[model samples]
Target: MSRTIPRTALLAALSLVTAAGATATVFGTSAGAATAGCKVEYQITNQWNNGFGANVIVTNTGDPVASWNVEWSYANGQQVTQGWNAAITQSGAAVSAKSLSYNGSLATGGSTSFGFNGSHDGTNAVPATFKLNGVTCNGATDPTTPPTTPPTTPPTTPPPTGGRADNPYAGAKVYVNPEWSAKAAAEPGGTRVSNQPTGVWLDRTAAIAGVNGGMGLRAHLDAALAQKGSGELVVQLVIYNLPGRDCSALASNGELGPTDIDKYKTQYIDPIAAILADPKYAGLRIVNTVELDSLPNLVTNVSGRPTATPNCDVMKANGNYVKGVGYALNKLGSIANVYNYLDAGHHGWLGWDDNFGASAEILKQAATAEGSTVANVQGFIVNTANFSALKEDHFSIDDSVGGTSVRQSKWVDWNRYTDELSYAQAMRTKLASLGFDSHIGMLIDTSRNGWGGAARPTAAGPLTTVDTYVNGGRYDRRIHLGNWCNQAGAGLGERPQAAPAAGIDAYVWMKPPGESDGASKEIPNNEGKGFDRMCDPTYTGNVRNGNSMSGALPNSPLAGQWFSAQFQELMKNAYPAL
Candidate 1:
C-alpha cells in the first residue's frame, strides 16, 4: 500500500492539516474544529411592561454552540424591576445578563432564544446592545427610546370660591306645588275648623282621608327626580295647600285651627316623615311649606277674606303660624331632606322692599321660634300667576310672544325677553354687592316664558348676557339662574338651535306637564286658554285671556309623554356628550 498510495487520498490529508493549522491560529486550540463551532449570534424581541421584557434570539453563526453570556447597560432612572427565562445580574446601571439552562447546543446558522425585563423613559432609554459569549452579535439592534412628557399650563383666573358667591339666589332650586287643594284635603285625621265659638267639626277625619296616601306625593317626588336626575338639579318641593292651617293668630275660614294644626301634624306631616324615612327616596331635598295665607292683612278680595278674625296683630306680634310651619319642617328634617322657604309674592304684587326684606324678617322670627338655625329658614320664593301682565312683572322678559310692542316693553319686550340674559347678570352683580352672591340663587319660571310661541333662549345668549353684565367687570357672578316651569311649549323643540350657556343650572318642571290652570272661563281660546292647546300643531287660535297653553293635568299620559320628550330634547341640546 505504501508503494502504490493514491494521489486523491494524499491531497485530502494535506487539506485537513492546513484547516487544522488555520483553526489553531484563530482559536488557539489544537481542537480547531471544535473551537470553530463556538461562533454565535444574538437577537432581542418583545420588550414591554411598565418597564420592558425581551426575548433574545441567539444563533450559532459559525459552528454548533453550547451556552452563552450576554451584556448590556441601562440609563439613569431606568431600572429593571423583574425578568424571566434568562439569568440576569445588575450592577448599578449595567447588566451582566445571560441565558440560564439554555438546553441543547445551537446548530451552525441556527437560532436559540432567551428573554428579560428592563426599564426605560422617553429621555435616556436606549435599546440594549447585545453580545454572545463575550463577542458582539450580528444584526442585533439597540433598545428603543421612550416618549417625552408634555408640559402643563396654569389657569389665569381662579374659580369663584366661598359658599358659591354673595348671591344666595344663584343656583337655587325651586319646586312648584301642583295639587294645593288636594294636599290640604289629605291632611291626616282631617283638619278641624273650630268655627271659632261653634263646636269644632270632626273635619280632621275627612281631611286626613283626602290625603292620597302618598300617591300625589310620590308623583311629585317622581316628577322631581325625573327632572333633577341625581344631584344635577337643586330640587325644591313647594307644598302649596289652600286653607292652610295657622296658629290661633292667623286662622282662616274655620280651617287649620289649633285643633287642625294638631291633626295635620299627626296625619299629613307624620306621613311625610315616614315616606322620607324610606331609603327609596333619600334624595328628595328642599321641602318648602308654601302657604297662601288669607291674603296679607292689607289685601281684600273674594279669595282674600279671613273666615275667622283678623289676626294680623297676633301674626305681627309672634310669627306663630310661621313657627308652626317651622315646627313641621323640623319634623320632616328628621326623616327627610328639606329646605324650607316662606312664599314671598312676586315683585309686581308685593312692594320690592316689603317682599324682600320684611318677608325675610318674618321668616327669620318664625325660624327662631321653631329652634331652627338661620340656614334652615333659607329665603323667599317669588311667583307669578297667569293673570299677571308682562308690563307689571319682571319675569315677563322670558315670554316668547311676537310683536313690535312685545319687542319694546322693558318688562316683557320680546327683545327684552333676551334681556333676562342681562337680568340674570345684573341680579348676580346685585347679590354680590349685598354679599349674598355666594349663598343665594334665583329661580325663573320658564313655563310661561315659552308662552305665546316664544323660543327657548339659547345658552350662548344668556351666558353672553350674564358674562357681559357680571364677569365682564360690569356685574358680579353671584346671581345664578334656575329655569323652572319647563313645559312642552317652552321651546324645548328648538333646544338644539343654540348652545346652552352657563349660569342656568337646571330646567325643572315647576308646573307639572298635565295640570290645568283652572277652566278657560278666565281666558279666551284665542289667548291659548285650554291646557294642551299651545304647542298642538293644529291649534291656530290666538291666546285668549292670558291662560297658559302649556298647563295640563298632572295625571294625563299626554302630559307625561310631552315631559319625556322635552327632557330628551333638552339633554340633546344642552349636554350632548356629557
Candidate 2:
C-alpha cells in the first residue's frame, strides 16, 4: 500500500464545503493592459471557538513564472500555527506564502492551492484583497472580460457536533467510489462486484484535494452525500502517508523522510481533518483505516529479529511512526462521525507467539502517544492490501498429521494461527487485555484472500506429513506466508458486509481487487515508489520468506497503480466466482 509521489497538496473544489460558509474573494487586476495577473480564492473552511482552517487557491491569469507567492492580511488578530503545500509565515497582520520546490511553477491559466490552521480571537473574516508576486489583485474579472460579480456564497451547512454513533457502519450503506467502480465495470465480467465499496486511499497530501484529476476528499464526501439520499452511508478512507512509511518494504517506500513527522502532521493529516470536520459531511459516517504495515514493522522488522532491516531499525529508533499515528488518531478521531481503525498485520506476520503480544503492545504505545489514547481507536483492521485467506475451511490450527502439529508445518511455520479469521479474533482478545475497549471490533481485508478456483482443495490433505496436510488444504496458495506482492494465485475475497462474524465489524475490500502490489521490474516515475524484488517472479527470496521463490505475477506495474492483468486474474479466480 506504499506508493510515494511528491505531489503538490492542491486544495481544489474545497471552497464549497466549510464550517462557517466560504468567502471567495476572486481577485484580478482592474487595469485593462495588465499582462501579469492572478486570482486568489481565500476560504475559511472550518471555524471553531478560537481557531479555524483556511484553503487558498491561486490561479495565474497572466504570464508564466518559475515560482509564485500569495500574500494576504487577516482582519481579525489571527496567528498561523501550521500550514501545508507552501511555506507560510506571518508578521503582524500580514501573512505570506511562497511556493515550495515541488509546486512553485505557475503557467498561464494554471492554478495551485495551499491550506493552514490558525488561531483567532473570535472574529474571523476573509481578507479583502490579495497580492501575487508583489502585484495587488483588485478586480473580479481578468483583463479581457468586463467586471463581473463574484461567485455565490458557499452552502450554509451548520457546524458539525461531537455526536458519533456507537457503530458507524452498523446500519449504513458504504459508499462505492465511482472512480474505482468505472475502472472495474469496464473489465470483462467485472459488473458482478464492480460496485463494491473500497477504501479511498489518501496516500499523499495532494489526495486531500485531488490527485491527477481524481476526486478529492471534499468531492468524495459530496458524492457520499448524494449517495446517502436519507439513509446513513459509511465512507471508508485509508489515512496513510506517514514519514518513512512501510520501512520493511521497498516497493512502498513513502516520500516523507524519517524525521519529516511535522510535514506528515501539517501537510497530510491536518487538511484531511479539516475536510472531514466540515459540517456538510456531518451526516455521513467516515471510517479511517489508519496507517497500514507501519506499527507492525516496528515489531517484526526492527533490530534483533532475523528479518530486521536497517531502514526498519531507523524507524524504530526515531519513533516517528508512533508519533505520527498517535497524532492522526487524535485529530481524525475528534471528528464525531469519523471512526478510526488502526491497521493490524495479518496472521502470517504477527501470529507467532513472540510477535502477537508484542505487536499489540506497541500499537497501544502508539495509540497513547502525542496526546492520543486507546479511546481514539474505534477498532483494528487486518490483512489490508494482502492475500491472506479469510478462512481455511478444511484444516484447523489444532490439526496434526501423524502426531506432528500443524504449527510445525512449513506453511504454518510455527505460527499460532493459520488464517485471518482466527487470528483477528485472537488479536481482538489480546487487544482487550491491553486496555483497549471491550467492545472494540475487528475488520479482515478479504479483498484478495478468497483463493477460490479449480486449484482450491475441496477436502483435507493426505495424512502423510504435517507439511503435506497443511499445504494441500490451505486456501492461501503462496509459496510462503510472507510472499506478499502481486501473488499469482490470489483471488477476490468476500464482498463487503457489516458484522460478518462475531467481534468483527465487517469483512471489507480495503484494498481494491484490481490494483497491483508492486512492479515486477524497476520502472521510473515521479511517485516515490521503488522496485522491490519481492514483486519479481524470478526473485529467489529473502529472510522474511525463508528463501522461497517469490510467488508473484510477472510484468506487474507499480504498487497502487491499476494492473489489468491482475484485475482479470482476481475476477477469474474469485471465490463465489463471477
The C-alpha TM-scores of every prediction are: 0.36, 0.73
Per-residue alpha-carbon lDDT of candidate 1 for residues 253-291, written as tens digits (9 for 90 to 100): 223433345555565566655655667566545434345
Q: Which stretches of candidate 1 lie over 4 Å from their true place?
A: 1-214, 218-236, 242-259, 283-289, 292-320, 334-336, 351-355, 377-380, 384-438, 454-507, 518-578
- List candidate 2 segments past 4 Å from native: 1-162
lDDT tens per residue, model 2, 1-578 = 22222212121222233434454545576475488788876655445567766666687888898898898887779998766667899999999999877568888877776766678886675666789987777754211111111111222223223466555666677876766764665455664676678999888778888876567888778666655645667899999899998998889888888999999999999999999999989888899999999898988888888988899899999999999999999999888888999999999999999999999999999999999999899899999999999889888878888888888998888899989999999999999999998878898898899898888899888788988888888888989999999999888988777777789888888998888889999999776788999999999998989999999999999988888899988988889676
The local distance difference test score of each candidate is: 0.34, 0.81
Query: Over all chains combined, what TM-score does candidate 2 have?
Result: 0.73
lDDT of 1: 0.34
Model 2 clashes, total count: 1
